[model samples]
Structure formats: C-alpha cells, structure tokens
Target: MPPVPAAVDPDTLTSLLDGRWAGLRADIRAEMAAAPYRDPIDLSVEEHRSRVFDQLTALAANDRAGLGFDKAYGGGSDIGGSVVSFEMLGFGDLSLMVKAGVQWGLFGGAVQLLGTAPHHERYLRRIRDLDLLGCFAMTEHGHGSDVQHLRTTATYDPDSGEFVVHTPDRGATKEYIGNAARDGRVAVVFAQLTTQGETRGVHAFVVPIRDDAGAPAPGVTIEDCGPKAGLNGVDNGRLSFDQVRIPREALLNRFGDVAPDGTYSSPIEGDARRFFTMLGTLIRGRVSVGGSAGSATKRALALAVRYAELRRQFATPDGEEVVILDYLGHQRKLLPALATSYALHFAQEELVAALHDITDDAPEQEQRELESRAAGLKVANTWHATAAIQAAREACGGAGYLAENLLPGLKADTDVFTTFEGDNTVLLQLVAKGLLTEYKDAFQNLSPLATVRFAAERVLGAVAERTSARKVVDRLTDGDDREALFDRDWQLKLFEDREQHVLGGVADRLRKAAQDPFGVFNAAQDHVLRAGRVHVDRLVLEAFVRAIARCTDPDAKALLERVCDLYALANIEADRAWFLEHGRLSTGRSKAVIAAVNTLCGELRPHARTLVDAFAIPEQYLAAPMLS
Candidate 1:
C-alpha cells in the first residue's frame, strides 16, 4: 500500500527535510560561514554579551541585518527566505539566534510592522546598519501575558506637544529586554496611550533609552538580569522610565495615531479590534520561533541518534557489544522523536508557505487564520523541541548530560520557548477560541431546516464514528493485517474521526457554557487544550502526508513514508488510552500498534546517520566532540 517501504538513500535525503528551499538554506549556510559566527560557550554573561555584540556589529557591517524588510530600506524583502536563514541559525547557537532575533525580528520588526513609513525612513537604515540598536519593550514585570493591564503610560502633553512616558510603579518595569543592559540605544516601547483624557489602549513608541557611550538616558533606569539558565550571551535586562519625554512623531502610527494637537484617530474603530490588529502584524515572531524550534529538534535528534549508533552497551553472548541503539528501549525513546522531528519540520515549512501567502496579498481573514495557525504550530514545535531534546539527552545516557555533548545547552535554552512568544497554554487557549469561533460562524447563517440537518449530521456522525471505531478495533487482526493497520489513509481517518468526535462533544458543552461564560470556559480549559492538540496533530500529519506525496525519488519517499508511519503510530500509541476510551482502539490493536512502531524503529536504526546527516549542521557549530 505504501509502495513497499524502502531503506533511506543518502542521495535524496536533503530534499526530504529542506522542503522547497534546499538551495536557500545552503546559501544562508555559506553566508553564515563567511561571517564566521562563533559560539564562545565558556564566556561569562558580561563577556558573552560583549562577544555577541561584536558579532552582531560584524553582521551589521556585512549588511546581514533586516533580511526580511523591503529593499527600499536596504533589506532583501524576502520574508520567507529570511525566516529560512533565521531557522538555520538556531542550529548553531540559540543565544546568537535569539539575540539577532531581538535586534532584527522583535525590535526592528516592531518598527517595520507597527510603524508607518516615517519611522522606517528615519530609523530603519540606521537600525539595519547598527547605528541605532533598539530593544522591543513590551513585556513588563507585572504584565507578561496580560498586556492589556500594563501600567506604563504614554500621555500626550498638549503644550509641549510630546509624549511623556512613565512607569507608574516597579511592576511596570520592562523586564528581560534584550540589548537594554548595555548596547541598545533606543527602544520601541509599548504603553497605554492617553490623549484628551481617554486611554487609546497599547501602542508602540520609538524612544531613546540610552544616550552617548551606552549610558541610560536622563530618566531611564537599567539593570542587568544577570546569569540565566541558558542564552547567557544575550544582555537581557530590566528598564523603567520615569517621565521620559519624546516628540509626538515618535509614535509608530500605522494602526492608530495621536494628532499633533493631542487628538486621537484610528481607522479601526473598536478597542479590541485595534489591539488584535496591531499584534497580528507581529505574527512573524511566532512563525520564526516555530521554524527555529523545528530546526533545533532535528539537530538534537541527529546528535543523539548518531551517538546511539556508536555508543556500545551490554555485550551479547558472543562477546560482541551491542550498539545501544540495538536495544528496544533506546529505539523507543529516540526513533519516535526522530519521526516527530520530521513532522515538526514539515509543519514549519507549511507555516512558512502560509506566511508567504499572506504576504502575497491574501485577504485579511486568511491572514488572521494563518496567525492563529502560527500560534498553534509555534506551541506544538517548541514543545516538541523541549521533549525531543530531553529524549536525546536520556538516549545518550551520561555523556548526553555533559555540556560538550550539546544536549544540556539545547534543553536549557529551548525550555523557555514554551513560555516565550506566548506561553504554550495561553497560545493553545487562543487556538481553542479560534476553533470555537469558527464553529459558531458555521452555524450562524444556516436556515432553520439547514440548522436542524447540520445538528443531526453532527450527532449522527459521532454515533457512526463510535460504531466504526468499535468495528475497527475488533477487526484488527494483530500483526496479520499489519500492512492494512499502517495504511496512511486509515491512520489519518482515525485521527480525524477522533478529532471530529472530540470537537462535536466540546461544541455541545460550550453551547451550554454560554450561560456562565466565565465559569464554564475556565472549567473547560483541559477540554479546550485537547481540542487544540488534536487540531495541531491533524495539521502536522496532513503536512507530513503532503510532503511525502511530493517526494520525487522512490527510495526516499518509501523510507520517509515509514518515518511518517512511525510518527503516526507513535502518536496513536501514546494516545492509545484516549483511543481506547473512545472505542477507537481495542487492546489487541493498540498492542499491535506498539509492536509495529518498534519494528519501524529497528528498520530505521540503520538509516539513523543518514537521517541526522540531512540536518547538515556545520561541524564547527555542532562542535559536539562526542558527535565526531
């Protein structure tokens, strides 16, 4: 059915992971090597930050910054290409990637996305050239996720015709701002804008935070956050502004604006609409994070799987030692993760395509849909990186624990990804809301007869799926129908049906929830998250299937199909409890799934090196001596 799964052929491996941009990645890698970015793992926070600053300066001098901006401001205007390169940068040093992202993706991006042409014309070229280093000042001590409640205020002064920005209390201090401690000269700060005695919600302003010689400006207080668990190379710090004044022109007034005379105006009418629209422009950050996380997952899986190939454990009766990977337990931990790493890789590529579509002038609704998808995938991929990296560490045993192995660093650095960009939980809640919103919209315009039919179909579909699941589980012929059991169509169908069942149940529950609103929604958080996971899982699998379908070579496609099958079965095995509870999997069928997964792992073990080799990490950056 899957054209007889074949062994991986090294000749076609790169095409599998590169998606549609192997050349672009190669070009980026070459440019990165020419720049000769260094990791400098042993430097202290201060020393490391200084070293990174110097590296960034070198990059800026090389005209390597602002890769995503339009050519008018000295950038290449290739958003997809830029993100591809940024994702590859993660394979080297995460701190460097993050610091660069801080400068280019967050700080510079705020101006590029949220600001009008004036902000770009006056500052972007200098920002790209490193003449004006800026920090994205958004997250505050008291308000990380709940930014709507931020206490920082930028009140307009009619007489002075300026915006006076102030942190009302210590809690309003900007925390964990990259480049703020030492190098950044300016900040794109977000604060509640007040004019004519009315708050106009959160807005961005370009304000100088540091003056000549890197000193805090007149009313700005700066403090180094000191050593962190990882990414010590970044100069993350806290800042508080006490009545800092900036010209009215400093406002990045694309979405909303304050007139020179202190009057407020915006094309968007509602406060909520304006807020979301402004943040939507910054969705590239989430997209970039997902891409980077996918790359990081590949690197870790490659490093660990390669080590497992060479590292020997207990000897067989013939006095020949077993390659640790020969053990079932070892393969269980690493191989499925290997498959998942592949899944994330494909999902990230799909995200990039969706982003390109939006950038190419897709409708506003399409852009919002992609934004929600990006948020979900960002959460999924980052969580995958965290899990995959940890599994890689454990798979390698003691050596993996050593810093030189790279697992230690990968784990610590990626752990924060689950929190940043948006907490995974919060982001999932967003996904759930989107799904629920769509569900409501679907039913909104239905005629009375059509509404009844729709409701009847949903209810009957659940009943049919439940019945079909029981039959599927009972008919599963253990390993005899192994080929049928692993059918891509069947596997995908089961996953989708399960998702449909869950969504239908949740929709009914949420309908009842409309009364209490707050209490019901809060109580349904776990269900909401389940819906998000199932949705993401479906997206990942769909992407994997489509990628497999596009493979030009036979051997590569067959082997990748196996990996895809592994990803499918591994997830099925992990969620077997849910399947069983829902009558989608019988005990025998579930056990068969486990056996099939183990078999797939053993089959893939021979190709482990080839799999990781496709990651194509520069040996210098990978620099894990054990890997060599």
Candidate 2:
C-alpha cells in the first residue's frame, strides 16, 4: 500500500526499485564518457552522429543495450530497469539519449512488437547488435498526425510474390525520420496495403535501404534534413520510395498477414481499428519520451539548484554574497519546476509499469486503455519538460547559456520533444477525443431513473471541482481558523479541483454546443483540444499522487508529498481564472492559491537537491556540481 496521509517519503519511493540497477546505469555513464564528443553543439551534425553511433556501439558491446528488453533479445533487464538506465543518459546529454532511444526503443521494439518469430530471428539480433541500423518510416510530409491520410502505397504483385512500395509524390515522402541519413540498412516503412482493389490501412514493411555493399538501394532516395535545433546526434532525415520491390515476407505479419496469392487478412476487421492498433504500438515510445524528458528536466534543475547554492549575488546587511537561492524570486522560478520534475519522474514509472502489465497479460480493451494513458502522459510530461528546462536555464543566468554548462544544448535537444512521436497539440486533441468517447460510453449506460441520477451527478461533478492546493490547505487549516485548515487531504483535493474545473469547462462548452455540433467542433477545435489537455493533466496528477502514496521511505515520502503539493499549487495558481469562472473558487481563494504555491516553493527550496538526488544519477552522468 502507498504511505499514509502525512508520512509520505522520497527515500522509500526510490527504494521500491532495486538499487543494483544503478550498475547498468553506471555503465551507460561510462559509455557516454568514452564518446568522442561530449557536447553536441560544438560538433557538426555528421560529427555529432558519428560520435553518437560510436558510443552506442560501445554500450551495445557491453550488453547494456538490452536491459529493458526480453532475455531472448539478449536483454537481462525489465521495463523498470530500462527506464532507470535510460533516464540516467539524460545526465550525460539529451541528444545522446534520443539517438540511443531510436536504436533500442524504436528499431528493436518495432521488431519485438510488430514482427513475427521469423522476422525476429532474421533481424532482432542484428538490430540489437547495430549490425543493421534502421529507422521507423511512418510519418509523411503531407500527413504527420493524420497517419490514415498517408499517400505512400504498397501494391502486391501475386505473380512475383512481392510488394511494390512507392511514394508517388514529394508530399508522400517520409520526413523527420531518425537514422535515415546514415548507417541504416532497412526501414519499417508504413504504407497503404492494396490487393484486388481493396486498399487496407497502413502496414509496416521491412524495406531495405542499403545494399550489402552499404550503398544506397535502387529506387530509394534518402536525404538529410540538415542541422536541426536539437538531437543533432540523431541522423534525422527524409526518405522517398519509388516502386521499391521487396519479398512478400517483408511485411511485419504479427497482427496482419499477406499471402503469396496477394490476399491480405487481419484479425482486426475495420480499416480504422487496424490503423489504431498499429499506432498503439507507438505508445511505448511515448512513455519512453516522457521518462526521458523528465530525466532531462531533473538534470537541468539539479545544475541550477546546485549553482544557486554556491554562486551568490547581492547580500544582506551582514555583508555576504547571498546565495541566489536565498531570494524568493529564484526559488519561485526553479523550485516548483523541480517539484514537477519529481512528480513527472514518479508518474512515468507508474505509466511504464501500467503499460508492461497490459502488454504482458491484459485483454485488448485493457491494452487500449493503457495506450490512452501513455498518450495522455506523454502530452502532459513533455510539454512541462520544455517549460521546466527553460526555467532552469534562466535561473542559472549566463552560465546556463554556455555550451559547457549543458543547459543550452539540453534546451535545443528537448525542443523537438513536443513535436516528435506526436506533436503536443495533436496528441492532446487525441486525448480529448478519447475523453469524449469515454463520457459518451458512461452516459449511454444510464437508464431512465439513472439518467436523472446521471444528470444530478454531472451537476455535482461540475459544482464540486476542487483545486489540489486548496484541498491540502483546507486539511492543514480547518479549525475554523485560517491556518488550522492546512490538512494534507485539503491540499490534495485543492489540487484535484484544478483538474476537475478545467474538465468541467470543456464539458460546459461542449454541452452548450450540443445544439450545433459541427460549429462547436469546427470553431472550437482548439477549446476541445484544450479540454482534452486538461483531462490528461488531471490523469497525470492522479498518477503522481498514487505513486507517492506507494513510496516506502518516510522522509522521501514526506518530501515527495510536499513536492506534489507544490506541483499542484503552481498549476492551480497558473490557471486560477478557470476556478474563478467556474465558481469553484473565489477570487480570495484564487489569490490564496498563488500565496500557498509561493510558500510551498520556499519550503521545497531547502530540499530541492535532495529531491533530484533521489534520482541517483551516476557521477559521470551528473554533468556538473549540483552544489558548492
């Protein structure tokens, strides 16, 4: 069970996982140390990637590459182990982390999830060994978020028993693809499958990009996307296929199959269902991205907090270079973000575990539920990561801008996160669509009397939305006295209120638009998307609360609880107008939200380093001194 109301601790939380995993984490750090280039901004794109591939080769050689995979794939670790190790890579550099992610999480995972037994036997080891690097060619220039609209097509030829893959025009070319510029021998290209005039939705094809001689394959056009704002170490590029023919077996037939006679069959019947199932496989990538983003944010905060302690500015009357952390403004800027970093870290762990559970044993619907959760978590965490890193950089002043300090590179590298895997806005819209479906399902289950109950419940749900911080404050200060209402539950509920209010806002808007559905949907896409984002935000907050409750270490638990409070408080204050407009909180309570957040920021200021330290990043991966 999770720790009780008042005794939550951080050390207990970290202790839930085996500390021996830190050894593999250390190996990754050593691999990073041995890399040719430590700072990517200082190296040309080719040089950066060349060095990254070299480092990846070293890590793969040492058997550190398979930690989170199955033993059959030469991995000795599980999902938690993989996450712990991958998060540590952020301490070295974000670009290296992305490149490593592509190699293991994408290429290897694609084979594991989408390929059959023979496919794995033929390509898994090579992918793991880096003997045959590959890129996931799913996104297209004309249809990034809309995977169903891709123009690339694969037509089957029964006479030759081959699939002719072609990107008919420039708009259909795969772009922003990692590992496409150099070293990839094959790609898991997604294209429309057609046979006998019946076109199936997107399917993954193992298309060879380079011949055995390491030269470009015929009919394949690969071009570099050039130097990007971040992840320079990744060979992000564009690929266009022109009637490229591959054997019938090239199709990843795990869920669907293509026969020698040009017949295509899938257990999933609908074109849309098959497409969604394929997209669901990418949720693991989203989870990994969330964890990676959290790790990077933690590293940035650690650097900024440590520097603030030693590097001082104007002092008090006693005459001393006061530590920047001594200023409330500095704490305000960095501490809450630090708190959010902690929440995201714990939340990501839970998401990974939840995904592992469903993928391993749950039914199809359960797996889809987990998939939605992963998508939601990805949107919430990554968006927060960009904001958190920027805050950490600004808190460090000019030192942060210096490439040597790692902040500028960290910022540049992480900038793409909000877009990669899925754009933040697009993903949130997906989450919104999911929420709408869920609501409709729940509403449909109601009978005549239950319909009245549902109506009443909806009114109550709208009326009782509570901000997380206020919940905590009420518990902490409930004696009919202002301070007596400062209960932990009150603080937690106050935090929950923010989420409920936002969701209610969307519900209210949609309810009003029930009269003109198209106008509401067409004109209010942004609002609908925002509502979906709010629902996702609520889900993440709940997960974070649950994870902290599960931590065993008392002090760590207590600290995490405080961090959770800060995270919720900051968000509530940031969106106070929602609470006010919804009649959930008064203007006075709204102001109280800001004051409480500020106060909590001050309380967390002292333990900021301790919170990030609990992450246990290896020394070499630590990047710099976190404290004087």
Candidate 3:
C-alpha cells in the first residue's frame, strides 16, 4: 500500500463517489438548500405530517419525484437518478425522504410496474403530479413478513362485475400503512384474489380509500397509528375493509387477470412463481431504502467526525488540550465505520445501476440474483446505519442525545429501517436460501435438504474458481503472516473462504432435517445467518476494490486503497474468532489482523474529515449548535 499523502482533494473523492448520478445529486442538493426543509424538533404529529406533505408536493411539482416513472407520464425516466435523489434526501429530514419514497417509489411504482396499460394511463400522471396521493397497503396486522398467506380477500362478485375487498378479521387489517391516515385518496392494496370458487393467490388492486372530500370511503375504516418512538412526520395508519366493492377493471392485472365472466388467467403457471415475479418488479424500493440508509450513516459520521475534531478534552503534560479524534478510542469508534460506509456506498451505486439497466425480459435467474443482492445489501446498509448512528451518538456524548444536535433525530428515524423494507434477520435468511438453491424454487421450497446438499458439495469449488486468478491458495502458502494481512487478494480470499465454510457447515447440520426438520433448522439458524452476512461482506469489499480502480487522481486512489484496507481488515478482525477456530488464520495472524486495524485507524485518522466530506451533505442539514 502507498503512503498517505499530506492531503487528498475532497472534490476528487466526491467526483469518484458520485459516479453516474453527479448531476442529479447536485441538483437535488441545490433544491434541498432552497426548500424550507427542517427537522421536526418540537412540532406536533399533525404539524409534522403537514410539513412533510407540503415538502412531498414541492418535490412532485419539480418532477424530481417522478424520475423513475415512464417518460410518457411527464417523468425523467431515470431510474438510477431517482434512487440517488432519494438517497441525497437522507441528508435532510428523514420524514420527507420517506414520504417521497412512499409517494413516488412505492405507490407510483406499484401502479407502474404491477398495473396494466389502461391503469398506467389513468393513474400514472396523477400519481406523478401528486394529484393522487396513495398508500402501499401490503403489511397486514397478522402477517408482516409472510405476505403470501394474507387473510384479506378480494372475491369476484361476477353478478355485478365487481370485486368485494374485505378484511376477514382484525388480523387482516393493514397496519402501519404510510399515507393511509391523512393524505392518501387511494391505495394499491394486496389481497388474495378468489374467482370461480378458486383462490388464485395474492394480487394487488387499486382500491380508493378516501372520498373526494378526504373522508374515509364507505366501508373503508382508517385509524391513525398515533405517535411513538420516531418519524412523527409520517402519518402511519391502519386500514380495514368491510366488504368494499370495486369494479373488476380496478385490478392491477399485468401478471394475472380475471375476465367479466369470472375466469382467471395468467402467463405464469404457479401462484408462488407469479407472486414472486410481481414482487421482484419492485426491487427499486429495497435498493432506495438501502441507499438512503447509507446516506444517513454518512451524515451521522460527518457530524460526529467534525465534532471530534473540534471538541477538546484532557490536556497533555504540555498543558495543551487534544482533539478527541486524536485519541485511538475515538478513531476506533468512527474510522472503521466511516470506511464501511464508503464500501456500502459503492455497493449501493452498483445496485442502483443494475436496477436501472435490467430489462423486463431479463432471465428469471438474473432477476432472482438481483433481488437476492438487493435484499443482502439492504440488510448490510440498514444494520450498519443502526449501529454506526448509535456509535456516532455515543461519540458525541451528551450533546448527541439532545434533539437539537440532530443525532437523536437521525438515530430515531433510521431505527425502523432495519425492519421496514424487510426485517434484517429474515432478509439474511432469504439470501442464504437463494445461495443454497442457486435461485431455483427458492420461494417455493424453503426447506429443501437436496438443494442444501448440492450447494455444500460445490461451494468450495465455486470459491476457488472465483479467486483462482489471484492464486489465493499459492499466496497463502508462501506469504508472510504480517505482510499478507494487507494483501487485498488475501482479504478477499478470506471473506470468500469464510462464506463457503459457513455455508457448508449449515448444510451439514440441516441434512439431519430428514428426521426433525424444525429442530435441525432451528439449531442451524445462526450458521445460516453467518453464511448470508459473510457473502455480503465479500461483495462489499469487491465493490470498494472496483470503485478504487475507477479513480483517476493518484492521491485520491491511494487514499481510497487504504480506506478499503481498513474496511476489509476491520471486518476480518471482527470475525477473527471464526477464522481462528477454522484454522484459516494462525493465532499470530489473528493478532496481526488486530494490529493492522489499529495501524490503519491511526493512518486514516488524518483523512477522516476528508472521507466524510466526500458525501457532500448540504450545510443546512449538518447545522448543529454544538458544531458552532
């Protein structure tokens, strides 16, 4: 690794970090600066919701909110730019960020992706212009993670050529639905469709929840969720349908449709396959959530890093106070997390680009792979935000706890991210399921011992095939323990090997599921999660490596190389016990990994400000009285 320069140009780092969406980011930053955006510090829940709604309308009026929609609907048709715009909004009020996501990304996105041509023609422009605010009513009170078996029913009433949308019981009521409490006039509701006496699985329908006067429509019960821990600006509400009837044409029938005669037809055969396919089309929402979480983490780190550089503590023998960041403990708290934020940023950029470029006709395996990647990155980014933001709060001491300091809002608003888009634990298990089955029948066969055995048999061979060019086996045999700790290839090999080994171990344990499936799966759950986490860690490291290769400036490139090293080594150090037990790293090498992390933290400490500044968050958002 090259020695750190006296200083690296932050503009260069910013340019490299911006990647393909530099213009959109700059435009959004300028617009946010111009808007009356502020954290809802002391505002009432109603007041906060009003303010966030106004902000959402402002975003819609500028067309910034519709970048992901089709151009025919007065949109920019820039999917990646749309996601980047949402991420940039994370630097400001999180409530507004989420409001925009619900309006444009979720509500509008469902109408665009799941609905057919006539549905789009009628609703797309209105949705884009905020003439029609809507909710994504998918999560029922009974089923948050398991959407496949929702109790809500939309039975076809062929006599009147209408479908009766009904919540069978309290469990079927949609809970925590954004836009349902106050602003939403309509909702894209998910319910099991039944026609001709046969249930055709879950499908989305366009259900109007409110009348033109903004009152709840007949048979639609809307209940405000009330205030709680955070995000008071969002008007989350519960929705229940008491035999609400809508025209047959209200169904978003691109994947599955029913005729006036009550006959159901779909291009896809099985209900499970068709349902998964529909959900797959909405991957942009998951990607946006992860990217927004990254931006929030960056903001927290920036605030904490700047505070560390300014706040002076105990004096030395020379009677001069030292900056908190000058201490190794402070660096340990912030620097490695800072490095991880950078890595996740690059991985997120790659994901947004993939979402932008993927075609509707892309192969099923390719689509599934993209979904798995989105799920994994979401897990990584959100969990990192939760931990790193808490760390930032602690690093700022009592000041961070105050709502005035901004860290409190950041911490509270982002706390639900880990569970909302998808629960982090459940999502990790999904990733492991995908890997074990190679995306084959992943949703259908959740307990496939055959697939687990197949994956275990070929997992090591696949790892070797990927790292063969780096000659990881030969280098690990010949390289010195101290020197090889800094080798990027060695680090990559370690991550890959760990994932392969953990996955194999999980398979071995699950093989006994032939007798007691529940007991075996319960016992091996930890190994399953580790397999998912290590796989994502390896991908994030690779993304950082690829991003470093794209830097044109020598100093910035060198600086990024060291940042990448810190990220990789810090991960290895965190999981050193696994490596030590598996005989992948010697006792001396494990200790060397820790030493390398300490050394890297010291070396990178000088550039911490530069690292956080590259995120280029607006000054207005980072304005805390403590910093002054």
- The residue-by-residue lDDT of candidate 3 on 1-628, one tens digit each, is 6789889989899998999988888887787777665678989999999989888877777877789988988888899998998888888888888888998999999999999889989999999998999999999999999989999999999999999999999999999999899899999999999999999999999999999999999999999999968888888999999999999999999999999999999999999999999988987888989999999999999999999999999999999999999999999999999999999999999989999999989998888989999999999999999999999999999999999999999999999999998888999998898887843443245467856755655666656544552354346456675568888878887787788777766766675676787898888898899989999998999999999999989999999999999999999889978877766766776788888899999999999999998888888888898899
Tens-place lDDT per residue, model 2, 1-628, is 1332333344444554324354555565565566544455478877888888887777678666776566776776476666656666766667667777777778777877788889878887777788878888889999998888899999999999999999999999999888888878889999999987788878889999989887789999999899887888888889998899999999998778988887878878888987888778767677878878877887777788778887889978988679898899999988888777766666676777676555444587777667767777787778888998899889988888887787887898888888888888888777776666646643445466755665677787744443434454444434442243234455455545655555555655565354587887677787777676666656656767777667666666666667777777777678777656755456666666777777777777777666666665554544553342
Ranking, lDDT, top scorer first: 3, 1, 2
lDDT of each: 0.83, 0.73, 0.89
Error of 3 at 132 (Å): 0.6
Q: What are the models' TM-scores?
A: 0.95, 0.89, 0.95
Predicted candidate 1 versus true structure: per-residue lDDT over 1-628, tens digit per residue: 4554446666477866776778888776777666665555567777888777777776676544777887999997877777786798788778778888888889888999988898889988888888888899999999998877788999999899999999999999999998887788999999999999999999999989887877789999999988899888888889899999999999999999998788899988998889988888898778888888888888788888878888998899999999998898998988899888888788889888777656535677777788789989999999999998999999888989988778888888888888888889988888877777757843454566756766787779777877877666655654465876778878888878777777777776665454586787788778888988898998899999999888888888888888899999999988999988887777777888888998888888787777777777766666678867
Runs with alpha carbons beyond 4 Å of true place in candidate 2: 1-37, 441-485, 495-518, 622-628
Candidate 3 local Cα displacement, residue 45, angstroms: 0.9
Prediction 2 TM-score vs. true: 0.89
User: 2 or 3, which is superior by TM-score?
Assistant: 3
Clashes of each: 0, 42, 0
Which model scores highest in lDDT? 3
Model 3 sits at a Cα RMSD from the real structure of: 3.0
